[model samples]
Target: MKRLLKQSILVLAMAGMAGCTTLGPDYQPPEVDVPQQWQSSLTEASTVADREWWKLFQDPVLDELIQQALENNRDLRIAAARILEYAARVDIARAGLYPNLGYGADVARTQSSRNTLGAPPDGVGRVGSNYHAALSVGWELDFWGRIQRSTEAARANLLAEEYGRRALVLSLVSSVATAYIELLSLDRQLEIARDTLKRRAENVDLFRVQFEGGVVSELEVAQARAEYETTAILIPAIEQQISITEYNLSLLLGRNPGPVARHASIAQLVLPQVPGDIPSQVLLQRPDILQAEQDLVAANALIGVARAAYFPSISLTGLLGLASAQLSTLLEGASGIWNAGAALAGPIFSGGELDARLRVSEAVQQQLLQKYLVTIQRAFSEVDKALISSQKLREVLAASQRQVKALKDYNKYARERYDEGYVSYIEVLDAERRLFDAELEYTRRQGNSYVALVAIYRAMGGSWVDAAEAVADKVDFPPQDAPESRHWWEYPPATRPAAQNQP
Candidate 1:
């Protein structure tokens, strides 16, 4: 019997090795077409985008705000929590690859009536006591690789969640920067409006004095008053917007509605030079794209797990124990008991449930494959759009600066001509109105330009928070120097190269 048990153990070991083969298609990333160069002809300078892109702005207030958002934002915290949850799931899936063991013990006493069977004349009842202790083990042989495939799927899911968290961080950084820029822009706008209103108020006084001196008509004074009131009205409107923007920014920082501190005005902020000559391949580093691919990987692995169900599932169970009627004999060799066995189960008929599951897994994998492709395409589109917006907005901002300069001179000359009685009050009014509009537009353009820059940084998958350092210490907001020119391929291999070039 001992020899038979050894032979059975050897057979099971051989069977396990034979069953180690994996089923279903191995994962291959779907191919995408990448452009060699962007359609727009932006300069091909080396991209410092890989560094914390926000550091390129060199603004201390913005740096601090982004850091706070990274630490305090609720959505970001949820994403981090999900990573832990998936990590635990990976552990659970991995546990299936090993045997489970348990220990148990029991002591019991029983009484039986003597008349129930072969009763003794002198005995009224019978009493017995029992003791038992056992160690039990069970394991399912992964001959069809179901457990391994499940583990693979879980690991891929964990990676996907990790990428998802990174993507959220990227988005959170962009959001905080965008909100901060808007706040500054609104502040600048409010300043311009107040300054224009002051000038209008002074002009109203000047027109009233001229009317009193019989040099100007009452109509002129009335028109000046109207202009002053119009400019005054803008103050409340802009102030309202500023309040709303601040509230929004506070939420981004995971704080209650309150004033946000700032040191730099919109004009004080300088736009960083665009990362010249970004290769089309850089979109692969985008966290969303990486996350999508990981999802696809998980889906693909599930297909194998589902396919594995079509084969027989083999399990081994064993129990070793001591059992005795008297507790004193429980540890003796004569009281020892043990049993071992194996089981094989296969679906003889399951109303097509197994087939349906396999189909479902395959369908899900195909869907994820499509989604992965879409993610890559969308990432490329965003980069293209950001590049175009940056280039065009730069031109617009330059024109706006020139327009503001020209209007400044025009307003001056118009006021002088009015003083010399060379032009009507209407001419002065026209110049002032035009100048006011141009100043607001210039401020708005500045803000838009900054916003576009933020968008580009987001599109490029730049990281402001260092993963390792973020965990160990408070984030530092040091200014970043431009990196040397390097090939885009030097970025991390989160994604594979596109199979075809864009036309």
Candidate 2:
């Protein structure tokens, strides 16, 4: 009997080792044709993609704000948690490759009535007790590579989630910087409004006095008051916009709606040097593209899993234990008992269910493949758009600066002519109005130029992400080596009451 058991175990091991080849298509990364260089014209600016691009702005407050948002942002937190969730799923899928070992004990007492015709003879007591203890092992042999495929799919999903989280980090940093720039530009606009209001108020007092003394007409006083009112109304409008922007920025920092601290005016913020000579192929390395590719990998692996469902599932189960009527004799050799068995279960008929499932998996793979391609295309498109915006907005900023300067000179000349009685105050008001609009536009152009730079960095992903991550929040995975600390899922279903309540 012992030799037979050994032979049986040997035969089963050989069968498992000789399982058929893995099913379904193996994943090979799809090659995408890329332009040798970006379509946008290249510049001689120093490359900033290899370093922390935000620090190029040289604003300490901006740096601190980005760090805070990275650490506290709810979107980033959700993405990080998704990585942990997928990692657990990978472990669960991998466990199918190993046997499950468990121990069980049972104690029972029974009484048979003597009045029953089928009762045991009087040699045995009417009431008796039996005790049994056993160790059991069950393992599903991977004859069709189902478990391997499932594990492969799960691991790919884990990687996809990790990349997704990284993509979120990249987006988070960009958003914070953009919002900060906008807030600073609004601040500059408000400053300009207040200064203009003060100047207009002084003019109103002067024109009213001149009109009372018969040196100027009442029309001049009315025009001065009208200009003063215009500038006065603008202050509150800019102030309201500032408040709204502050509220949006505060949300990014994961804080309550409130004012955001600034370290410099919009004009004072340094313009980051554009990264030059970028190859279009670099878009493949963007976190979103990588994440999409991993999703494709996972989908491809699922085809194998679904295909394997058509084959028979083979498993080995064994038990070795002690059983006896007497507690003290349970440890004796005579009480020893053991059994080994093999099971083969396959779908005899599923009413087209298995076929439909396989079709579904195949369709999903096709969908993901298209999605991956779209992601790559979109990545390249974004880079192109960002580069163009950066270049064109720089030109806009230059022109706006020149316009502001010309308007400033025009305002001065118009005021002099009015004082010399060569022109009406209406010319002065028109020049001042044009100058005020130009000033606001110039400030807005400054902010947009900086924002375009941020967009460029975001679109052309590179090592700067690692540099940013060095200062951002850190997510720690659960320690796998700590045997004493068990996850709720590790507990048996009957023993884990808390698992039912877990999310």
Candidate maximizing lDDT: 2
lDDT of each: 0.79, 0.83
Residue 206, candidate 2: alpha-carbon lDDT = 94
In model 1, the runs with Cα more than 4 Å from the true position are 1-19, 44-46, 113-125, 212-214, 462-503
Where does the lowest 10-residue lDDT sum fall in candidate 1?
Answer: 471-480
Cα RMSD to native, each candidate?
7.1, 6.1
Clashing residue pairs for model 1 = 44-276, 44-277, 45-276, 45-277
- Leading candidate by TM-score: 2
User: Model 1, range 111-229, lDDT digits (tens) per residue?
Assistant: 76665666545644477889999877778899878888898888778778767877877788888899899989999999999988888889889888889999889899999999999
Evaluated at residue 124, the lDDT of candidate 2 is 78
For residue 83, what is the lDDT in candidate 1? 59
Clashes of 2: 0
